[model samples]
Target chain A: MSKSQLNLTRIVLQDLWHNKWVMLLALLVVLNAIAVVYTSHEGRKYTSQWDQLLQERDRLDIEWRNLLLEEQSRSEHSRITRIATKELNMNRPLPKNEIVVRVP
Target chain B: MSKQAKRKQKPQLIQWRLYVVVGFVCLMFTSLIGRAAYIQIIEPEKLRHESDMRTLRTTSREVQRGLITDRNGEMLAVSVPVKAVYADPKVVHDKNGFADMRRWQALADVLHEPKEDILKRVQSNPRKRFTYLKRQVTPAVADYIKQLKLPGVYLKPESRRYYPTGEISAQLVGITNIDDKGIEGIENTYDDWLTGTPSKQKVRKSRDGHVVERLDMVQEGESPNDLVLSIDQRIQQLAYRELKKATEANQATSGSIVVLDVHTGEVLAMANTPSYNPNSRENLQGFRMRNRALTDSYEPGSTIKPFVVAAALEAGTIKVDDIIKTNPGRMRIGGKIVRDGRNYGDLSLSGILVHSSNVGMTKIALSMPVQELLGAYQTMGLGNYSGINLEGESAGLIHDRRRWSEFERATLSFGYGLMATPLQLARMYSILGNKGVLYPVSILKLKQEPEGTQVLSPEVAQSVMEMLVGVTEKGGTALKAHIEGYPVAGKTGTARKAVAGGYGEDYVALFAGVAPVHNPKLAIAVVVNEPKGDRYYGGDIAAPVFAAVMSGALQMLNVEPISKREKVRLAANSRSVE
Candidate 1:
């Protein structure tokens, strides 16, 4: 190689060595920006998952209330009595027919 | 000069200009850094809060109201989640005419409303933001409407109160309004305990109006406290059935029955006939809505005779076997004449109660101090609020000492001057059956034994109870009140209904009693208002109802029969049949 070309290469290498800290800082800044973007994206994904879970909980709560209401309506005493006396042909025993037995 | 010299001079000048430019650029960079530092460090929180305010929405969540259950955990009242459909009229109006018409038609079809009506409602106030399309729609209907995706249409979660037992428990469990607010009965009394507090939360929404994040709870919602009442569903149903039967059979105006726990002073059942169905408010009339057992008071006729007799005994002026002459069936007291249906010539104190002689009660009452009778009545919870916390409860009128005249005092002996609700009469009988210990009555379930005051000596109460038992025997006034295996002890009251000026032809038949006289567990009172036929007497009308209800209630409660006479009679009848 010619001396001028070699001299030019040496000057370029020296300039790079002198500004190595600035290059490292620029690389770090780019890495940090990528990390920020990735974490924010993950956060949004998890938040949506949490929202889905909340909605599921609300839906289940409503279902539970409905079931309780249904159970109450079905098990009402008056309804049972009506069914027993009407549909089942049941009748209360006469007082004279009821016998007392003591259990020991 | 040579060309090389010119180049060297230009390079030096260019270097000096470059230094000035670099200095200006650095000054600008420093200014920007300072401004950025000021924003990031000094006022970061304020700016962040301002940004959050714009994007972070606060929403209120409705908490479910608590359930009301009977003593055995049978649900009486419950709150179910429903949806309320609302519309933003302005949004509907902002659309073009065709689109708006299409939206209205779709919404109307979904809501089961007329399309023209919906359109008119929307256009009536174009500037109004919100209007209710429908309230308390089922979740399924709400889901269908939501799928339509009509602009400005929304479904908001709400709750509705439901009564499972319907009219049987209407007057006792009470009713709630459309907003899930308690308006009557136990619902009104325990509203605060049954109501739930709403919660506010912060949420982040996406562009499509989906909640993407739940930030934090601004305020925590409190789950409502469930109410455990003292009423037994089985007994309540029995009382309701019997009261309805008797009221219809007698063609009476209305009736009320109350069954109380003698030991706990807990009202097991309170049923009022002509009760309205709380679920539907369409045809509910004022008369049907009255909780007569707690709200209305009538002059309780012979029901008060026992109290006076007990007072006479307590004052030591009369003994259990002391004979008083009820000769000729009538006597004049002050200005009023008290009479019995027949001349029960002479009677022991127990005989007086058995015959329900008005003259006998008046003779015993006059022998005692007036204050003694009043004090006894007051101690038995007459003329006072029962502390049940029911709305519009009547403190039945018992005139004070200063207002007491000779005539008032005489009529008070026969249960004419003083008045009492059926519940109060039941409580009085409960006090007697509980060995004279007056327990404070409660409509709510008691977790522990209630405190009671000793109003009558146990001996005096025992004697009074014995006399009451005679009222249900073969020749007693309430022979129809007899149950097959249980010895019922009670009094029959046939009070002539007082009109505006004088007594009317109508009568209020009342029977107040306790069953299984050996170990009384229940105290029941039945009042039939204005019975039509020859069965207008308390013995004929109210006593039979008491017999039917008490028989079933005792069997349901598993109360063992302790009557020796009933056992002997049953054995004899069986032997004769064999």
Candidate 2:
């Protein structure tokens, strides 16, 4: 090997040995940057999950309201009366036919 | 040796150029520091706002209105979620050509509108950001439109009010407008309590228009508050059926029936015939929309006789059995003649009421001071608002005491000079059934019984009730009002309707009564206006309606028969009918 190139290699090795704390600090900075990237990505994932849940809740609420309205229309008095009198052949009994049996 | 000397001489000149280069680098560094300071300290707010505007968005959400239910928690009205179709004209014109006939035709067909009309509406306001294509479309239709994936078209969520009972309870429960605001009846009275507040939110969205983060709540959303009414759906249906049948059978112009719970003073049912269906309002007319029981008043005819008799009894001027002479069946006072159909000699007070003698009632009313009789009427809730919270309730007309001439006083005794609504008459009868305690009427269900004011002594009210009971006997005016299994107390009124200057040939047949007289569960009033049939008497028209409705109502409520004697009588009556 040439004498100057060999001398350059020795100088570099010596400098690295002397500045070990600075090298450790540089390694720590790079690790912290990686950690920041991972945490931000995880945060975005959770936020999207929350948004999806909220939308699902809204959809279910609307469905529940619609079902309640349906129940109301089905159980309306006029409709029930019509069905009872016409389709079921039911009629109100005479007062004389209704016997009162008292429960003891 | 000469070359080494030349190199050493040039090194000194190179040092001066290095100083110039160092000064130039220092100046550039200072300029960079100055710009950083300006951005960080001088105008930070503006820069931060600009960045936020690019990432953050504000959105608003609508909420549903509340439901209206009966006392038994049966839903009478409800709000259902719907969608409104809107479009941005500018966006449509920019994305698709302004003259895109195919797109317009597709939209028109989906909306059930003409293609030319759609094109005209969009082109008329080309600069507008938004225009409504259709409002209150069914969710299924909205979903179908969404699947079309048309540009510049969007669906916004909204709500609509629906009435389940249709025309049966339409006048009492009322209806809401297209914008979900109550326009009449109980709905109008409780509009604010039934509406819900909307909410606003701030969120951050990603590049693809998906919400990425919930930033903050700008306003909190409120769930709607439901309302519970005092009306019983079963009784309301019965009353509506009976009133409609009577009005149509008699060929009457209109009719009203009011049923009150005697104990609680709650109006169980108030129905008016010629009602419009709240669901479909395409051919609705103004005349058919009135809630006649509470909004219209007529001269109450013989319904006011009981109050005058009660007042006389209270003043110690007459007893239940005191005899009054009506031998001629007619009397003249101040050039106005009062008449009864037959000459009855020395009729007892109870017999007078049973016979509905106009001359007997006039003699009793004129014996008392005018102010005292007026006071009695006012105390009985006549000519006054019943404090019911329905919209457009009328306080029936009562003249000033100073204007009570002899003729007016005498006619008022027979129910000609003053007016009272059917609801007011029902309330008065309810007071008697409640043993003279006038409980405030309510349209909402009560959690506790309210305190009642003593309008008449209990003894006087009972005596009057006994006299009224005589009126439903075999020879009484309202024999048709009797239910076989219950004792009924009722008064019948057949008044000639007043026209422009004199009385018209038309009549208002009225019957106000309470049934199961021993316990008195219900007070009902029936009015048939201007019956065109040959038989227009209260006994023939209104009393039968009262009996039909009361019988059904009592059975529905499970009110027991008063006594075994009544049961036997009912069985015998049924056997006779069979």
Candidate 3:
């Protein structure tokens, strides 16, 4: 019970009441910042993932075109046929060229 | 003391009532706060994305359609990007207070259209926020309008079809509508393959109606497949040019030429004169796109005789050296008289083919049962679809053996009482050229070369092939078709048009020929509907075109010409270019 002790207790009590709201506000700000950062980070992933998938789709499309071209080249005509026939010994058949009798 | 206590009790009851009312109000307020938190904070993000879809104006993007190209990579039809000019009528009209200086007048000058046209288009929808003033505007014109920066003016993308080769090969390419929907030809037949999927995008807009950002593209559409045709552009142009000139020169109604690959049965080129550009499809009639090769059927005349001879030989009913007794050029069988253009003596099947003998073929066909001949014709691709790339086709007319009469069968032997499309004849000859194996005519390369169906024995086909070669020799019907350096096999079919159910003097001249007869490279079936000239025979009219077309194709294909004995004879006959 000294005079200085009494003065110090009164100061501490007033300061406690006055600065209480600051601590509460700091807590709220921390919570809100964490929420915004986490949500935005999550939202950003969707567009990037879609971008990667689109690139993959493009690669697939080019592959498909190449395959089609390859297939077409494989079965494509080798040489002009009528031209080959005239040069080769290929000729149309005739009636007299056949020999037959009744099977019965 | 009692009075004071009663007064205290009354005041205390009033205080209690007041406290109760305050508590009720606080409860109600708490309920409202909870509901607001649930809606505004808990589900706010979910609703926020949804509102962007509706309130935020997003652009609906359309994809470019696929192009139709020939086998040789020539673009038959393609779509070019265009812009549609639109305006907010309310914004434009209200901005221009003066009557003469109205937005419509400016628009009319920019559009180069009449004032009334601009006025009517805008005024009809005066209050509309956006109205299309013109569609399918050129990019330069649209760019100019965009530069004007007029209020409420907008440009939307559209598609316009273009035909690069003009009318050449137009019929097969087909036409598209104003919305780029295919209407006819290959366009309609393969619409599902050509229609690309439209991709949708969702964008977020700021409160002030300015675009804030482009979100993910939602509901991605699939791209349609591309169609590669089996058409040779050079051959098509050659045939088209020659046929056009010949048709105009002869004053013929129209003409058609079809060149087919012998082994694969691929339609190398199908060209018809009097064709129209597919780009201007609205003004064109169906006639302009008719594929006469598959649509028009006629008696093939001598074009059919080779088939009959081949059938007889394949059936083992005749031998190559078998003799057929005949007068010089005529024969009578079953009350129907058959004759050739010139007299031919008694000859074997080979000699008959060399002479292009109609009477000899008739005798051979009649000697066999009618059913056997009909079966052979069917096997050779007659009386059925040729399976060509043409949209419409005729099965052609060959009566069933059950309906066949003796005279009819005999006439059919020489290409009468039987009908065939040019496509069908080309296909039949293609089988003959393919060593008696019939392949489905392919306008495009299949995943694999279709296994051919056996229609004739290989030996029988070889022997018949020799007879076919004779038709292009010194005394052959298609002597003109013989190239000095290329051996050719062909038949001339001069069919008198059927008028009033009877034969008319006017004729459809046709030639169904396999070129380089010794090693058939191309089979061509040509038809001139009605040539108003001194020469109406297939040998004179159509055979020459076949020769020109095949020769040009050979040269383009870099095929080395094979000079035969006939070329020496031709050079000797030339007598120093006399």
Candidate 4:
């Protein structure tokens, strides 16, 4: 075609070749920015999960304490004695009635 | 060429309009740049703070108070998560919370309050921000209230301390206030150790209540510490039951019983009569709440006779075979006559203890130096703190005076001039049972046995312990204290209550002893005050309780019975001698 157009195209190619490193760096920076967004999103998701887990731990702890209290109440000494005497017809044997067995 | 010629004719007008338009556009751009610079440089914090107010939140984790268990890991005191129901009055009015009257009635029923009272508290102050509807309701009740879904009604978490053993250990484990603060007993002593601090953190939250980013921690959480006491629940229950029965049967005013471990000096059981239930907040009398084992002091009566004998033996003034001549039933000491029920004539040391003769004890004390006797008492841990380190403990009074009187010395020998708590008496007995090694008293469970101080020579202590065994044998003072399968070495004391300048009609019945004499395991003391009936002797009331508790405790701890084997061996040795 025209010699002037050919000269302009060659000059544009030389400029692009000279600035190739800068272009690559710009692309990497864009990719890093996108990566930052993705990681932050993932971090938030995990944090919420951890928060839920902490709540679950607290709930279980409360339940465990309640169970301990319940067990203690059920095994109370006075209640056991009452049950043993009234319901089961049991009593502590007298000292004379207890037989002494020696172990060799 | 033709267009250029035409343009040249209107060039002046075009030039004027272009200059005006350019100036106006430049002015608009300059103003925008100036505003941006002012905002960024001068007033950024205002908008930043506003954004933070919406997004930043400080969240805290709930921390419960610690647990208190016995030596065997049985729970004595526990904290259960509860809820404090409150209301935002202003919000209630705005949300028309009272529109549904049935919901309010249901809440009142659950809270055990009248509907009008609950509504009035909310309606009384419309502008008020907050008010408590109820404090420390159970989680089940809190859940039920949540189901009602009354606007402005809210429930926040709290904790409540509960004692499983109730009145049996009320005076020892103590009770906490509604705000979860320890107010009395062991709970008060270790309040700081039993409390926990909640953790706090700052986080950025999104619009949908999701934690978007974690920020710096405001406070690191500390898990609460737990406490393990040395008290055995089995022994404590047994002691309380027996003490309650004895006091009720005798119609006594009050009583206290203390059982100590002879080896470790651990207080296995300390029970007081007229104890109130810690669970119920009704009728909590001051006298009833007193741990009389450590707090109340009284003249120890004949119980101190054994220690006096031990002191005389230690001081080399009295020998194991010394026969003190007690002729008449009474002897005049500085115009005051100390008398026994019967004259124990020309008796050995063991006979004096068996008869519990006041005249016999007086003669022994008068022979020894005053300081020598007092020093022996001090070494045996008399009139001093029991080393339990509990609150409201009295050191009991011992007159450290230069001036002396003969009658005072005589009275001190029989445990009248000085005073002591029941726990001190038990400790002295424990020393006797432990072969003169005085261990520091412990209320908390110990992982290892602590070093003990040699308070008395092992020979003197053993000889004294053997002599005390006669008091529980046939025709001795404390016949009731004798166990069927175990030999008990104990003394009986019936101290007449002192009034203004003289004595009162009341008597303090007491018995202190150690059981299974071959290998002493437990030392116990019982004190009953002011029986209404005629039978106020320590042998009758207090000795029976001591026997019942000690026998049961030995069985529970699996201490072997020494009766059959010892008797058979003694018979065989006697036969060979014959």
Which candidate gets the maximum lDDT versus the true structure?
4
What is the Å distance of residue B314 in model 2 from its true position?
1.7
Model 3, C-alpha of B437: deviation from truth (Å): 1.0
Output the lDDT of residue B565, model 3. 63
| Interface DockQ of each model | 0.37, 0.36, 0.04, 0.52
Stretches of candidate 1 above 4 Å error? A1-54, A101-103, B1-55, B97-100, B205-216, B401-408, B563-578
Report how far off residue B233 is in candidate 1 (Å).
Answer: 1.2
Index of the highest-TM-score prediction? 4
Report clash pairs, candidate 2: none
lDDT score, candidate 1, position B269: 93
Q: State the lDDT of candidate 4 residue by residue for B199-243, as single tens digits.
A: 899999988988878899999988789999999998999999999
**Model 1 chain B poorest 10 in a row by lDDT:** B569-578
In model 4, state the lDDT of residue B493. 94
**Predicted structure 2: lDDT:** 0.85
TM-score head-to-head 3 vs 4, winner: 4
DockQ-better candidate, 2 vs 3: 2
Residue-wise lDDT of candidate 2 within A1-104, one digit each (tens)? 47545676778989988998999899999999999998977887788787788778878978877787788778766688789999999988866568888999
Interface RMSD of 3: 11.6
What TM-score do all the candidates reach, one by one? Answer: 0.85, 0.84, 0.76, 0.88
Q: Indicate which candidate wins on DockQ.
A: 4
Candidate 2 at residue B94, lDDT? 82
Worst 10 residues of 4 chain A by lDDT: A1-10
